[model samples]
Target: MKMPFFTSFILLVLITQIAIRRTSYKIESKEADFWEKERKANFTRKKPLDNLNYIKIPLDSLPFGKLDDDESRYCEKVIRSLADQKVVNLTGFTNTDLKLEYGAPNITELTKYDQNYTTLVTNLQKWGKLLYDAELYNEATTVLEFATDTGTDVTATYKLLTDLYQNKLTLSDSEKKEKISALLPVAEELRSLSKDQIKRLLTESL
Candidate 1:
């Protein structure tokens, strides 16, 4: 039995729509399954910090197995002195006393010690800036170089050094231009700093 033309066309359209709907449903299901699996995998993975066994060690005990007996003894004495000062208010002994008692070197002696001393870097950077502000360019350059070479913001140090060479000291105009050109990259990186900070740095450096 042959159907009417209109009925035949209607049936063909309905079949095409159903087939498209089925294919779309399958694609959506696959995407949903993929995302669900990804979420599960992510949840199962260990976090980076959680997997770090070194963090389990005490902060004072970090970089373990790196220190020798003398270094370890010096570190312990320093820690003890700090703790005593904080807990017992024992402030009679000067830093020199502590160094003598621990047989540890003083600042000058320890200048050649491990370059990773955060406190030393802080002090040197502070002193460097003070000297720079006092118009002592040579001394400031030496201190700042020590601080920056030992890993305290090399970019800032370079910028300051360049400024000192350009504006503060007696460099020739050609030399000043050369130094400024050399420091352009460092300045670009530090351009994100506040205008006030940039001005303060330039003022001290010059």
Candidate 2:
């Protein structure tokens, strides 16, 4: 038996719609899987101290940031003090990265000026992870953005924050592209700088 023309047309339309839906679902699923892989990779590495240029501040009778106590607590206090602030101005400290290179504070009297660059990065990572777990991507982004200014050692924080912005935040493709382009140079610049150079750039930015 021959089908009527309208019936055949309707059947073709339904088949096309099903195919479109399946294709769309497959594309969305692939994207989700890729993002998931990226997110999981962040946890595979050690936290902030891994790739940073920090010297562990000694706990030799220093009233603040005693290392024997909770390291995270010490970092948390440092981070809070830096809230709503941009990169730390190196001018605040006596320029001594040159002199301190020879003898570490363990022997020399440089303990008073040894900078704990890792602490802020560590705290930022913790806070960003907390905010992300709580589904506060915007807040996480804000915290991570502040961390970026503090130093380039915030690779982990920056990585996770970018993931949140890309996957969780609602942004157009063009806007996302623009942001990534702008951020890549900063990351590269930070990576290239020595500890002293980073301090100089950060202080000059202020």
Candidate 3:
């Protein structure tokens, strides 16, 4: 038997309410769990961070002056400011993880380390793009390679490298494929939201 139109509408509304309630419950559950973990995190003691792998910026090796535009010069200045800075690629780790790893007291210093890493990676991407835009293919690759080696999770960095290997750089067919193939593990290990996109791009390119 066919249900009346009003009866069908009411049934649909009821189903929707049930789904909304379930979703709200899940959200509340997760929030409660996170808070409980955070409370534990506060009690964590300081851990040694002396063994961190710090990234060093190769300022002299990178192509820094092909373009004299305002943006290019600004990026160079920013990069130079980081010459003496400490950079560590802790991209996949979260705040809670940091607190747990190095204790709450050391979070401040750890945060700075990560901030420098982020700053360097971001500027590297911009600098590389600027170089690529100005037809500085080899120079762009140098910048991009440094970012890649430092474990940047930025998808654009991977994309730029892929483009250069395939079309821009003067590499043999096997060499091009080989270089791109090496990026798979790096992309696969990414915890960034863009991980899937980077993986997909690399997979298809290979």
Kindly give the stretch of ten consecutive residues in candidate 2 with the minimal lDDT sum.
101-110
lDDT of 3 by residue, 1-206 (tens): 45698899999999999999999999999999998888777889988888888887887898878899998888888888888987788887888888877798888888999999899889989999999998999999999999888889998999999999999989999999899999998888787898999999998998
**Tens digit of lDDT per residue, candidate 1, span 14-119?**
9999999999999999999866754554444222222211101122522222323554445434433332221111123333333433333332332323222434
- Estimate TM-scores for all models: 0.31, 0.44, 0.86
Each model's RMSD to truth, in Å?
A: 19.6, 18.4, 2.5
Question: Lowest summed lDDT over 10 consecutive residues: which window, candidate 3?
Answer: 1-10
Please list the C-alpha lDDT of all candidates, in the order they appear: 0.48, 0.52, 0.89
Clashing pairs in 2: none
Best by TM-score: 3
- Superposed model 3: Cα runs more than 4 Å off: 1-24
Candidate 2 segments exceeding 4 Å error: 1-78, 81-97, 100-114, 191-206
Ranking by TM-score: 3, 2, 1
Predictions ranked by lDDT, top down? 3, 2, 1
Candidate with maximal lDDT: 3
